[model samples]
Target: MTFENTKEFAQQLDSQDKLNKYRDEFIFPKVNGEKVIYFTGNSLGLQPKRTKAYVDEVMDDWANLAVEGHFYAEKPWWDYHERFAKPLSKIVGALPSEVTVMNTLTVNLHLLMVSFYRPTKSRYKIICEEKAFPSDQYMFQSQVHFHGYKTEDAIVEIKRREGEHNIRLEDVLAKIAEVGDELALVLIGGVNYYTGQVFDMKTITAAGHDAGAIVGWDLAHAAGNIKLELHDWNADFAAWCSYKYMNSGPGNASGCFVHEKHHNNPDLPRFAGWWGHNKERRFKMEPTFDPVQGADGWQISNLPILSLAPYLASVEMFEEIGMDALIEKRDRITAYLEFILQEIDKEVDSTFEIITPADPSERGCQLSVLLHGEGRSLFDYLMENGVITDWREPNVIRLAPVPLYCSFEDMYDFGQILKAGILR
Candidate 1:
């Protein structure tokens, strides 16, 4: 599709967009009584208009039903998190029994590590990308430390080749093999946080398996942004927060996926809680811990109804449109954003290069642009001018054209704002 750097063209595109009507479902922030062109869904999603009603439903159940709400509320609070199984499994491309909504992302990561990252004395090394999200870095460090190993020796970080913005798949696969017998696990971000590079998870999973290693992913950015097939990929485990593309709310409950192969394995180590106990025998309060059948076995505590409510509210919309449709719109809208940025760079004398991959399959909705000279002011200029793109350290500004909320007209407005920013 040919894109024009004009509001008329953008408006025309928006007019034809199949997902355009869904934008009304969100409540956007305003600047000086005007709605800003929000492009930060990769950081925190906009509040769904229906979120309040969903939360209120839970509140109302609590208000009248009290303790009885656990079993008797319209949507029982006892199995509140269970509601996410079907929608989330569909979203992540896993079987319903393989998925469960639970604690925050990092906590789930640690829990999954407890079960999947079994580093024996002979093979205790873990391979991951350099500059992973700080939470993941910390988790890896602590987990290594807990096992009486040093981070420098036990954690193998794969850096981007010198002068390159993203790690090559070949380099990643080679590193997995190079680690060889010492490699115990391969954990990586599904979509890299800083560069928005979507890794080939299926191939990576295969490589890790061939090298005699378990594999997992921190899907914080990839979960709702890109298409994923966790089950087909045969990933050992994965975790993701709902706050970003999932648009559940700030610091919302996260979801986890575990392959069915691990479900019945009583020998697998995990931190247990009552919620993970078998429902039939949970009320018996027996001394022996009877674990649930599948991914539900990994839960460490009762579900947070309030937090999960917003997720339900957001995912219901996902259920309506479906991920295939969302991805179709995602690729086109992101391409439009990339095109606008490239056009702006051509017209401007200053240096502006996209750090994200050029191939549509290699990225999601995000485009990370590196601004060479006089860039900090330009980032500030965008923020002050009612454009809501996010800035990373050094000189990169991240803009995500979210399919469910952002429109093509907003992309045009962003290009115009960026041009003015460079000049001013």
Candidate 2:
């Protein structure tokens, strides 16, 4: 659909959006009694109104029963952690038993590393994108160093062929072949946080598997924003945080998925904890720890219900809308945002270049715009006018218009604001 920079045209598009009503579901941040057109759901999502009610139910249950809430409440605390299974399973496209909502992003990443990244003498290496999140690079480096292996030899970093911002699928497949024999595991972020580029999980998984290596994903920025079928893709394991597009509160619970294919594979190692032990004898205080089946077997502790309440609220919305439809709207919303941004750039001196892919299917909702000429000041100018996008290091400003909360008007309005901010 072609667009022009007119308020009437923008309103008409918003009017036709089948998911238009969902904008009212979130608590929009206000600036001088005017709703701020928030487009940062890629970094953090707006809170759902039901979040309070969900938390209240858990609080009231705890208030009334205190210690016994673990066993007696309607959503028993003893089984509180398990409540996340079915809903989280749907989000990442996995079986219920293959997922669990647990520790934060980095912690889960560390735990999965301990299990999957076992470096041997002949085949003792890991492969990851060159510009991975700093935390992940550190985690990968430490894993190799702890086992008396040099980080340089034990980790293969794939760069984007010099001038590129995103990796091509063919390049990734070729890398797997080139490094296949010596590679132990391929741990990649499902989406590049800086570039807002969504990686092709199915093809990458196939390449890694064919190369005789395990493939795991860090889905920190991809989970709720993208439609994923981790099980069908045959991903060995994956982890994601809930605070972003999932609308879970800040530092809220995180989740992980382990494919059913690895459920009982004796070769797959796990870091054991009491909660991962067999439920029948978990509280029996047995000396030996027998892990449960599936991804629940990866769980380490009883859930923090207070932390999980926000996710329950968000997942209920996802269940109602169905994620497939969400992605359809997401693609439209993101494509509109990108089209408008580029169109706006055309109006200017071509000062801004998009680092994320133009293909809607290859990206989530976010657009990473690289503003030339002292970029941080340009981002500051947008923030001064209440245009709330996130800026990564150097010069990239990320704008994500979440379909669940953003409008076409929001996209155009931001485009106008950005033009005024930059061209002036």
Least accurate 10 contiguous residues by lDDT in model 2: 30-39
* lDDT measured at residue 411 in model 1 versus the true structure, 0 to 100: 92
TM-score of each: 0.99, 0.97
What is the C-alpha local distance difference test score of candidate 2? Answer: 0.86
lDDT of 2 by residue, 312-332 (tens): 889878888888888888888
Clash pairs, model 2 backbone = none
lDDT of 1 at 405: 95
Candidate 2 at residue 156, lDDT?
90
Clashes, model 2: 0
Candidate 2 segments whose C-alpha is farther than 4 A from its true place:
none
Q: What TM-score does candidate 1 get on C-alpha atoms?
A: 0.99
Alpha-carbon RMSD, each predicted model: 0.8, 1.4
TM-score of 2: 0.97
